[model samples]
Target: MSGSTAGPEALEPLVRAVLAALADGAARRGGPVPAGPPDALAEHVAGEYAAARGEGALSRLTSLLAYGSADPADPLCAAHLHCPPLAVAVAADLAVSALNPSQDSWDQAPAATTLETLLLGEMAELVGYDERAAGVLTSGGTESNLMGLMLARDRVVGRASGRQVELAGVPRRGPRLRVFTSAAAHFSVQRAAALLGLGEDAVVPVAVDRDLRMDPDALAEALDRCADDGGLPVAVVATAGTTDTGVIDPLRACAELAAEHGAWLHVDAAYGGGALLSDRLAPLLDGLALADSVSLDWHKLGWQPVAAGVFLVRRAETYASLARRAVYLNPPDDEEAGYPSLLGLSLRTTRRADAFSIAVTLRTLGREGLGRLVDACHDLARAGAEAVRSHPRLELCSEPELTAFLFRYLPARGPYDPVRTDRINAALRRGLLREGRAVVGRTELPGTGPGRVRLKLTLLNPHATPADVERLLHAVAEAGRAEEAAEEAAGRHTGETGEETP
Candidate 1:
């Protein structure tokens, strides 16, 4: 076992082998990803699995997995909200993994439970919540959003009907319960509603402005319309950072509306919560403190590994709906005897000690150090946006609010043909993936239009230079040109032979 006295001695050799395999795999790939089609990687994986011979299996498979992965650390791999984890954080994670503590019971993870409690308290203060606030670490934004909506449903909906939602279910004959979020808000809100037995149709999509942020006026109108239709507003979910353009909805305005309507305000700040670290950007989240609950994803912007998500609430008492009394986990006698338990705080039973790594990371790199990293990435995004604006082939969809921007490539020789442009942009992204030249992101704008397709640059790597951004853009333009040329050639051949060629 890793917790045994001889754990370090046993791990040393295995870790060394794994490290060697990683280096070898990265060296062989030599780019963000392996240059080939999806099937090629699949076949390689199959071959490796079939050829695994007893002792060396770990090394062989580790190397194969590393080679196939799209390395987020690579400057060119600016695809999703995925960040390259800091070495310090990863090292801390190793310690947590070795011990393998579960936080469901106090006895199972004594120190871990304490650390998680303290971490959540600090995070609550950072979010402007008072000492009565409480939170729990989550897998990511999806679970966080679900928890927030779930509390909102039980607290608000239950209060209105004067019934306990946990013991009793949602009433069928009550006023229609509704949730309001921006058109650009994360899809998790609707999914959460569905999971809570409120059908997907219960969500009212508030219109967004040109910048893809929720219009406060539109939100007000929607709320009024819901009231007019005798529908109860359960919650208002405001997105702090939209995935496509990174635009934040007007928080203060949304908060005001939610309060006036007696609706619970849940801010999905999974992408923008990192702004709290930076003095320059923290002001953008001015009214975040007013939220009833908030979701933050450290994996996206806190430079932690995957699944480092946090969910917080304004008051601990609001979490009553999730309280539990498992005799083995958190018995009344244990609580009376002053032994703490975290079984009631999570949607999970056997939860890992994820807070340990976050605590280590916070201590190692103080607030100032993490803030600087946030500023660096923000600076990089601004610089990259300027580059996109200056380029003839690139068209900036909007200036970045956080660390991501949206832009599309324009063909060098074509008259403005929206359909053809969309096709070329889509094809170019796939072309880059096949060639392993770059790993850029792709997304469509809010509307269903011919020109909605856009390439994205989510610059999460703070160390990546302006030159790297310029080079990635150039690679995208080159790929776009190749795709355009192929399309034109195909059209010419079809015109000559009167038959479409493959």
Candidate 2:
């Protein structure tokens, strides 16, 4: 109905209602998220849905969604890699949704096919790829990673066994294929390996340095071991921004080592690719141009809506592994007639026109505008790290590399107890969530131990100020104090209950 000629007129009133409902919902359950236990929030949402049995279902459901969302735009909601999208991008996405053009075939999405092709070219250039590069828009980093590794598998394993992997499947007696990546790399690598018929154990985790970046020497040793054991080194995945600390592995070293071992180099820049826009931070990813494939997510730092992920390869020829044909979609005659189709480039059969939003954002802001926003967030993170260091109860764990830092709250009065400290840090984050005061991230430093737990703050909102970050930290400390008091009170209660019947 939204695609009809009268749709615009019909949508005007509905759009206004949705806007009003959004405001009302945000005002009703304020802070970062709805304040209550998880079950209570769920029940309230169920009740709203059940009550909306008539004409106003849209208004009620939209209101409930906005109310329940963990608002990334809120300064206190520095929890994850989620970003607040720009208004221009959101508006562009609305146009795409109304039209509903599927990108799988040429006739289905003529203009969109061209737009996505051009956008991928520009993104490939951003990753230092030449004109021969080819890529496709994806759901996010996870899918992009899968595409990259799938290509690596078919190319490497197929060559070693001299057979088409797509037809015969991985040869049981062929050389073993191994993927080398830093221990800090995203878990998607193992998942991709498993999905490709290479068991999860095929992934070898190389050691990382003190800063949590992959050590190049360790990678070389792993590659050597794999080759010595009659295994083929299929790919080396390097992290441009690790999830917890935002540390980039030594890219130049990893690329060189991968090349020496005849392995594909794939850089997972899902979190740090936004730095490419900033002149100040671009130098950090010096060897990224050497990678055979790269994965980027605009939803993280590019300020676009979700599903704005891209996967690019250095040469178009390498994408042959993903090529496909369907008579109903893109016949040989259609291609010869110059009616290009995007069916061959993607693993998906039906895809949204997600590129439109990213293209609009790029034209609206340009490089310098977005770069300034990136710099602003980075500055806010530096200010936050300083605040954490100066606070008496907060202990700074890692320095900010992009726009995130890790730190944890220490007990104000007691001597350090790793077990108790971990518990306090864990409880404080939930305590803030329960009160609807703040939304902070919690993670553990890599290793096995009680003291590994740490709180994280991923600063993505450029409009957020240093004072806002300071207030967030203060709230965390206060919550930590409250948790400590509760622990002591519970301990006293247990001791009193266990007392002999005097």
Candidate 3:
């Protein structure tokens, strides 16, 4: 074949080979993932990879971080926040990559930009925002939070007299722009403050209630103190769903306090924003539209692939603070034509059309279908919590608030030893992952004496039933018992207790 035609035809065979391999693997495994890892196949692939990398030229490129090695779709895979993408979303992602559309401007993206805008409008409506609401697509919750804080900072410091701060080079000086959030809130909020020239100390850590929700009274008191001291309280960051416990802060109360204090209210609803789809938990997000800015992650609960997040603002003009003009790119003539460019609204220059997958998923699963998925996961979490509480070996740390539960395995007939308990629980978790039996999560919570290390379960897989979670709990308990028995046997033979080894 000619060189021109051969290059294009060469990829055809490789694509066919990959599809054939995938079909055969799926058939042999009977599903996406088997009960355990394919040790032999993994070893063979590693050997081939090593040979292909060879000496100096490509050795550094072989990082051993190969794809398809971890079974994220397995019922027992519950360690991290990662999840397998839906088939529809995955297929749409492939097309997105093939198209390689840059959604930073209307001319560049066209249909993709419109799709993203429509989706953001839909999401804003779900949060009860009015026609004045607008948003921009982001990488994930972290970027969304960062963008939201940037807007808040701009609103507080920029445009005091209908003039642009950047064009005038206005020197911002005052109380240093402090923000407040609960202790249980995600770390990204503090990080955003740091990046924005507000030191970490500028992020005041507010107290939480017994259920881990932020206390509105405490927040109001904090604001009052700041006001008395002449400190600028710029924004109040509230967690709609905490990363650890999935507890949502009292949004309505927080909004009211923020308004009274003359501060911007930003809600980090990355995890629980999908609950807006659920009729039962939709009320938990009441007054969310009252927030000046909101952050959401479509990858977490929206069930789209990775890098689907959004940051919405109640007022569309808030983005003008970050606006810029470039002669070669977005010229003055183009601005007058009503062309929309995302460059003024984002921290990125070249951005992928991540919202394509989200648009496809939402179109495939309408509002009702998405809501049902969210409700189903919540119900499964409740069932799993009940099973854990009923079991003699496990103790529930708190009730199920969202699709997450915190608990620890308790040994029968003994006073809880903090060091030994931590070691035992850690070993059980490691064993679960190594043996592929389950991927039970671990966390540290305040205990009676010292803080105790505990386990957590964040159920995001809609296909995961209550029985699957029960099996996982039982397996963890059995592993814990075995570790305890081993510790007892070692203690009996030796004069030392298990504390020394740990």
TM-score of every model? 0.97, 0.97, 0.87
**TM-score, ranked from best to worst:** 1, 2, 3
Better of 2 and 3 by lDDT: 2
Write down the worst ten-residue block by lDDT for model 2. Answer: 493-502
Per-residue alpha-carbon lDDT of model 3 for 421-480, expressed as tens digits? 677888787766555467677877633543377788887888888898888889899989
Point out where model 3 deviates above 4 Å: 1-48, 53-70, 159-173, 446-449, 492-502
In order, the Cα lDDT scores of the candidates are 0.91, 0.91, 0.76
Candidate 1 local lDDT, 1-502, one digit each (tens): 6778899888888889999999988988899989999998899899999998897998998999889899889999999998999998888888888989999999999899999999999899988998999999999999999999999999989999999987798989979999999988889999999999888999999999989989999999999999999999999999998877778889999999999999999999999999998999999998999999999999888999877999999999999999998998999999889889888889999998888778888999888899999999999999999999999999998899999999999987646777767778999999999998899999888777577888999989989999999999999999998987887777632323233356
lDDT tens digits, residues 1-502, model 2? 6777987888788889999998988888788888988999999999998999776998899889999989999999999999999889989988898889999999999999999999999998888999999999999999999998998888888888899887788889867789999998999999999999999999999999989999998999999999899999999999999888888999999999999988999999999999898999988899999999999999998999998999999999999978999999999999999999989889999999999999989989998899999999999999999999999999999999999999999987556777777878999999999989999999987789678889999999999999999999999999999987886766632222233121
Worst 10 residues of 1 by lDDT: 492-501
How should the candidates be ordered by lDDT, best one leading? Answer: 2, 1, 3
How much lDDT does candidate 2 score? 0.91
